[model samples]
Target: MLDYRLFKQIDDCFASGHADKARRLLMEVQSRSIALRDEMNMLHIRLKTLEDALQLARNLFNRDGFYWLKTGDVTQGPFCPRCYEDEGALIRLERTGSKLHCPYCHASFIGSARAAGGGAHHAHILPFV
Candidate 1:
């Protein structure tokens, strides 16, 4: 967690054996190191909190992980975060390209290379028929 750039600078000074400047830089490095350590501890606490929330979400959704089955006329869920957005929309839709439209709401679901996840890439359309 040390600011690696500053750590490197201090290391270079130490390696050069410039005792006076090295001493000063060493103090700076040590101070930054302590500050970085405290920051890391804070992040650790945050990570623990998120893990707890994710676990609780799994339990509430009756699922074992980040994914969960969405219920309704759709009958499928446990979708990844991106897919969940479409699930939230009034109508589920996917656009294969600039030309395609939502089968349900007739909304344009333009395709984009930026939509990169395998399962979450294209909105899988389920037939209402």
Candidate 2:
């Protein structure tokens, strides 16, 4: 299958409108399915999903800072990046009143769009040089 560099090459090929080459590279990965572990096989499937999402450029970090996945005409979100990347898990964030919380790590925030620095409008301290 393709490694990170080859995947990047595929990205470059697609960027240059070389669909044939990109598809070919994707096929190489699919063709090597038998040699890949179950996790790898699953990852390839997920990668394909991500590839389409990226192509659409619809996957975005919502106002609350959680990654939202767009599906067709609908958008789903509040995904925790910490869980997704670290544990290979797609854990959704919980909206509790004014805060979006990640249950996995207990990390909570009001998000940049909503917070605007979360009440720190004036500086009481300066850099001591």
Candidate 3:
């Protein structure tokens, strides 16, 4: 079976802006899971789910306090990145005129700081593969 601890670690890495590290860790877990004689199928499924979440993170357009999923050549959201990183949520903000609203936390904002992501401080994630 897939351990909840792995998911927690993945969440930690993502919350700290370590998508690459989370992906590496997921790969390592997947490799180790190959040796398990039972519960292998279920574990594989869970690993795949975790990987998908991180992949979503990678594709996110980091905005001021949220992230947008740029998919199909169109930007999909002004989602709360904090919610996504914390709980793997894709909480979409409701657009009202020039302001966007997050129902989860009830925050209001306009525009994006998407370009701000490039200069974010890197986390010191341990090497894993």
Best by TM-score: 3
Which stretches of candidate 2 lie above 4 Å from their native place? 1-64, 112-129
Q: What residue runs in model 1 are displaced by over 4 Å at the alpha carbon? A: 1-17, 61-129
Q: What digit string (tens of lDDT, one per residue) describes model 1 on residues 8-36?
A: 77678778876678688778878888998
Give each model's whole-structure lDDT. 0.49, 0.62, 0.67
In candidate 3, position 110 carries an lDDT of 58
| lDDT-best of 2 and 3 | 3
Best by lDDT: 3
Models 1 onward score TM values of 0.38, 0.38, 0.48
Clashes (backbone N, CA, C under 3 Å), per candidate, total 4, 0, 0
**Candidate 3 lDDT tens digits, 58-120:** 787665555778776677766765567777788987766756666785556555333333433
Scanning candidate 3 in windows of ten residues, the lowest lDDT window is 120-129
Question: Listing every candidate in turn, what is its Cα RMSD in Å to the true structure after a full C-alpha superposition?
Answer: 13.4, 16.4, 21.7
